[model samples]
Target: MNYNREDELKFRFNQFIISKVTGENKDYYSKLTIEDFVDIKNTLSNINNIITYKTTISFMDWLRDHFSYVDENYEVYLKDVLKVKPSVNGYDIMVTGKVNIVAEIKCNKPINNGFKYGSAQKNGIIKDIQGLLEGKTKVNFNPIHAYKFLVMYDFGEHSLKATEHLIKNIPSGYRGKVEIYNDKTQLKIDKVYVVFIK
Candidate 1:
């Protein structure tokens, strides 16, 4: 099936996953023809949906480790801290226990073959940032102390573009004191860590 270098690599990787899984292949990826990839690519939702879902799952796995609290109230505390469900505030994840945390997952693949954001994507990022840092919500939640995050999915080498975009376009109120790509593991406004997981 007419293959380019990239397609060949992906096909080989898919084969490897199926082979090494040892039993049942949990991967949703099938032995796709080049034509099939092209078809799926045309419907961006097909790809984005998968990426977003997988990213969320992976992030949650990491987060559970990060929190490392066996307490069931971590769930209740997470919501009580937020005073609203994620669906209400459009947050992707929130956890409260040893430390409060709120994150927005962005599984957007870069457009223009680089990191430039489409209008809607840009708007969404800005909104999430405002919501995270500025506490834009009807709820009584104060996000100032929480670890705010904009967890972006990097497809290939697009993450740097995200870093660059954020640096250039940090919301006005936070622009003067923003820190990024420093020795510090997190971005922040003063001492408060606003982690940008790229």
Candidate 2:
């Protein structure tokens, strides 16, 4: 059967629990009900959520710490790691990589109010790009690279249209590219790669 990442993780977690329980009480395995498995799945989901949230938070801190020092070219000691800093009120994860390519990384899941062409998402991204261009937003480090928007989500038709709207609205000079990524794509965290050019 086909399994997503979450499903695989839950299955492995359940197997581990089952093995431990069977070791302690062999009869317990036979006594387990569907409800018990459901509970285990829910618990694993919650744990995964917590871990993902923490890891996201830690990534920003890690970027800051790792790129704290730079040589004359402002490149991080780790050649592939991009320089990052906080952005405006709504935008987050500003990264500057090789050749002064500056990008705003926006991450969203596929469900619920994921990144779309909604007013909030559109305006927020526009504002961030405008702010960066106008030098209104305060950044820890300045990037001499081109501007870009790095969107991490499973794009739908609406999302594609929204991205197009965003790209069209940006000022001519700062309009660089919009990179899209989903579960199927292999994202390399070590280096900043441009996926599309505006």
Candidate 3:
């Protein structure tokens, strides 16, 4: 199985994500040679199905076991959640799944964000989840379908656990609670899908 596209895309995305996360606002594209991206794209165009599956699983497992989420909030404001976005979206990851089921990628690292002590920055994540939940609950989207939360963490298990706690406690107004996914249960995540790439 060959995962050249996946690998190349991730390599590019890593450069992009890290720059954004660390306030390195320089244009990364300017530094790249056409041959580099072409190679990655060609690799993806010829991606093998077996490689795709194996690579995806391996990537997820590495993420789960190797990194831990640390707190880092971005300056972007999410109006729906009425708070600044967390740094999770800017991590060295790229997510590709159905937009409807996929929420933002997050890091499960600890920080001194305003909301809670050493908790994952809750602003954007909560907002997106809540918005989706409200949309489903009010039949804005489709209430009949069970609402799900897909939290993709970068580093720590603590933030992952914190997300699980918040999700489990979604207000009574909504008919569903947040469901967390790991390697063991990721296959079961047919409802709402989230992919975290790094």
Q: Candidate 2: which stretches are off by over 4 Å? A: 1-98, 108-116, 140-147, 168-198
Summed over model 2, clashes come to: 2
Task: Please name the candidate that would achieve the greatest lDDT relative to the true structure.
Answer: 1
- Expressed as tens digits, the lDDT of each residue in 73-182 for candidate 1 is 45564444345332555466666556777776777666777777777777776777777777766746677777776667766557657556765876677564434333
C-alpha lDDT of all candidate models, in order: 0.60, 0.44, 0.42
On TM-score, who's better, 2 or 3? 2
For all predictions, the C-alpha RMSD in Å is: 7.0, 10.9, 16.9
What TM-scores do the predictions have?
0.58, 0.37, 0.34
- Cα lDDT tens digits for candidate 2, 26-77: 3343455889878867877665335433443444444444344323333332
Residue-level lDDT tens digits of model 3 in 1-198: 767875686567767657756656555555668898798678666444333333334444444353232011111112222222322232122222222222334443445432232433555566555554444332334322332434454335545555556656655643244565556654332343343443
Residue 92 shift from truth in candidate 2, angstroms: 6.0
Off by over 4 Å in 3: 1-100, 113-120, 135-149, 183-198
Clashing pairs in 1: none
TM-score of 3: 0.34
